[model samples]
Target: MKFIYLDNASTSHPKAPGVATAIANFIEQGSYNPDRGQYSGANDTALAILDLRRRLARRFGASSPRQVIFTQNVTMSINLLLKGLFTAGDHIITTSMEHNSVMRPLNEIRAQGIRFQVVGAEKDGSILPDKIEASIDANTKAIVVTAASNVCGTVMPLREIGKIARARDLYYIIDSAQLAGVLPLKLSELEADAICFTGHKSLLGPQGTGGLILSDRLHHCRPLISGGTGSFSHSEELPGALPDRFEAGTQNLPGLIGLAAAEKWLTKQETKILKHELNLATRFISAISEIDQVRLIGRDADYCQVDNPGRIAVISLDFPDRDNADIAAALYDKYRIMTRCGLHCAPRAHKTLGTYPQGTVRFSFGWSNTVSEVEYTVSAIKDLSQR
Candidate 1:
């Protein structure tokens, strides 16, 4: 039987056309660490890294390439930014739909006298800007939120919330793990202080590659890790620079190079890919909505008809009378359809959506999925529901 992969939200499969080749070429050519050696090969590597940063800056609409700081992944980027920016007695504002990447770090910092308020999102994973605005106050230090929910792919009202943050003079940080590459992002419009993104997910790049785009307005965030940044090695203290201050130790050169190639490939085909994924999601939702046992989570099917209802190609379904995990397993075993079944690491989101203990089965479509695959999956679900 042929297999269908629909878990792009976790990590994209068959990454961009040249991603693997780029990594392979880098390895075959003898990978060199930039800023560490004085040789021409090392200098060339350094320039390549700079070029990637410049590309990312242009893509994300950052003011300068120097403001782009890379980390191992989105989780590390969020931890570094949140921990460095907050201190005792500070307050933060986030949402119930955030992934563990943001919530876990905030939970850890809470022990240090820093407190955060979660503005509850609607049952459909939609958040209101006023609710977030109401949550902010005198002690509020920053507003950190995910651009879209990983569980349901409901896009947040970032522009409105960013406006609120700017009017209040508060820092706005966004976790773009599920947003980047899936949607168009322009930093100037969002008024964000930082956007943390991972290359493995919607970016269609390999793992171990991600970074942050920082605004010039944010200056006081201290370095989370302190070590050799290939700059100011003679000094005992960390270097006081844009990227070197936050980036410590050896970098992921191979992964970064692959990500660069992936970005290049994705830039040309983003619109067509997005349209295809959305159409697949629309077909799946329409078919599954007719089944009595299937309960669609997040946005209703009507939202798909509009030009943009602020949603991605992620769909979650709950078999109220059947075991969600069992359904997922059956789909994989009997039909060769791969999916994720559980709270998806966002327990708070599950609680908000009212699927807490018995989590839903998530089918996140990707650029490569086709209408025939979606129809077959729907047919399988219908057959299983009847049985």
Candidate 2:
């Protein structure tokens, strides 16, 4: 049987055309130090990096391209923003649907006197703007929420949350790990103070390419890493500007090149990307709902109970009689179908779903997946029920 890769929530595979080619091109023909040289190759390479940055800025609708600072991944970008903004006695407001990426760091920092309040989302995994607003106190310096749940593919109402954050003078940080490709993000309209984006997922970029977009409001946030930024070598501290200030050490030029290509490819297929993913999710939901043993999660689009209504292409099913691990293995061993089974790294979401110990079998779809692939996956699940 051909492999059915359904673990896109982990990372997207079969990257866009030219993604690898871009990486290879960068490594072979375009390799040059972005900084510390006035030679033609170095100048040309730096321009290439800047060009990618500009594209990233445009992708997120960032007001300034320089604000699109690259990092190793979305987690790194989150850490960079969280560590930089949070301080002693500062309280942050976050949603309960957050992955370990947000919770782990907040928990670690909370031990050091940094405080945080996690407002629970509704039963369908949608967080209310009012709930987030209510959690804010005088000491609350920021409100951070996942732009979409990685576990369930539920998008959140970040724009409304951003409004509340702005009204309360709190920094609004969005983890855009799952929404960057499947949904639309107009950073300026959303009032997103910062958006942590990964290139490997929706952007169809290679790994090691991700970034955070800082709004003009955060003029005082500190840098998580202090090193040579090439632009202020005379000083010992990292540069206190966008992009350059946060990006420390040498960048992954090859990854950035791939990222640029991926973003370009995504731009060419913007409408198709969203519609295709949503249609696939709808199909998965429609097909899986018909199965007696599998339970579909989330709400109907017309009756959106969550702030960000309607899930993306990730369909998580609860097989009550079967062990999640065993079911996952059966899919792989018997059908060559790959999927993730467990809490999906977001224990909070599982606890919300009341499936903490027994995580659901996650079938996350992407642009590369076809209708036939979805049909085959559904057929495999149907077959699994008999065994």
Candidate 3:
């Protein structure tokens, strides 16, 4: 049976053209470790890594290429920044709509006498900059928030929040796992101290590829992991450089190559792809709203605003009397329609949407999804609602 994949929020399927080919080519070329040797192959590999860094820096509007550091994934990227920057007695302000990537690390650091405050999002998953500012206190050292909600696709007011962070002299960190490729991001304009991203989601790259784009303020923060950086092998301490300071040991060369291919692909079609995905989402939401048994989460008046960024392709539906997991399973087993159900690693977000204990069924569209697929999925949901 032909499958209809709607779980792009978890990880994008059908990655950009040439992603797999790029990975295979890199591996076939004898996978040389970058910056570890002086041979031609190693030098070429190092150049490729540098090229990827520069490409990412330019694409994201960073001041310099040195600001981008590759990590295993966005999780590792966020952890590196969170653990490395904050210490005892530090305070952080974030939103309830954040994914575990932001929440879990903060919880881990709480034991070190660090504290964090969650600025609750509106019922429609929209965060107010004033709410964020109100949460700030003298001890507040940073503001960490997601660019978009993974569960509902509610895009935060990042520019306003960034301005607030700047005026308060606080670090502004953005978890852009859902927004990197689907939205236009100008880190310089956002005034973000650091933004974390993953390659497997909107970036359309292979898994195990992600990184952080940070400002010069990172020079004061410590490295999460320190070891042989290949640059300062002669020294006992970690190299006090931009990328080499955070990146330790050998890196994910093949994955980074795939990411570079994906980035190139995204740069060429960002506008068209985002419009297509958002249009599909709008159609899906309109169709699903007509079903009596379906309750759409975060689809309220605020979400319907023309300028509301919350209207990305991610949509969540709750069945008032039916189990969301059962609905998801039925969609897969009966119709070959794949989706994600439950908390989606964002229990706090579920709590904010009042879907905790029983999460909603999520359909996250991607560049490859079509209007026909959305129609089919809506038909199936409508048919199932009556049963």
TM-score of each model, in listed order = 0.98, 0.96, 0.97
Residue range 155-260, candidate 2, lDDT tens digits:
7888888889878778888999988876678778888788898889888898898988888887577877778877877888667776777878898888888988
| Positional deviation of residue 289's Cα in model 2 after best superposition, in angstroms | 0.8
lDDT of predicted model 2: 0.83
The TM-score that candidate 1 achieves is 0.98
Tens digits of per-residue lDDT for model 1, 119-182: 9999899999999999988899899999998999898989999999999999999999998997
Q: Model 3, 26: alpha-carbon shift in Å?
A: 1.1
Q: Which stretches of candidate 1 lie over 4 Å from their true place?
A: 305-307
Q: List the residue pairs that clash in candidate 3.
A: none
User: Which one wins on TM-score?
Assistant: 1
Model 3 Cα lDDT, one tens digit per residue, 113-184: 999999999888889899999999989999999999988888889999999999999999999999898777
User: Any idea how many clashes model 1 has?
Assistant: 0
Clash counts per candidate, in order, are: 0, 0, 0
Position 30, candidate 2: lDDT: 56
- lDDT for each candidate structure: 0.90, 0.83, 0.89
lDDT of 1 at 117: 99
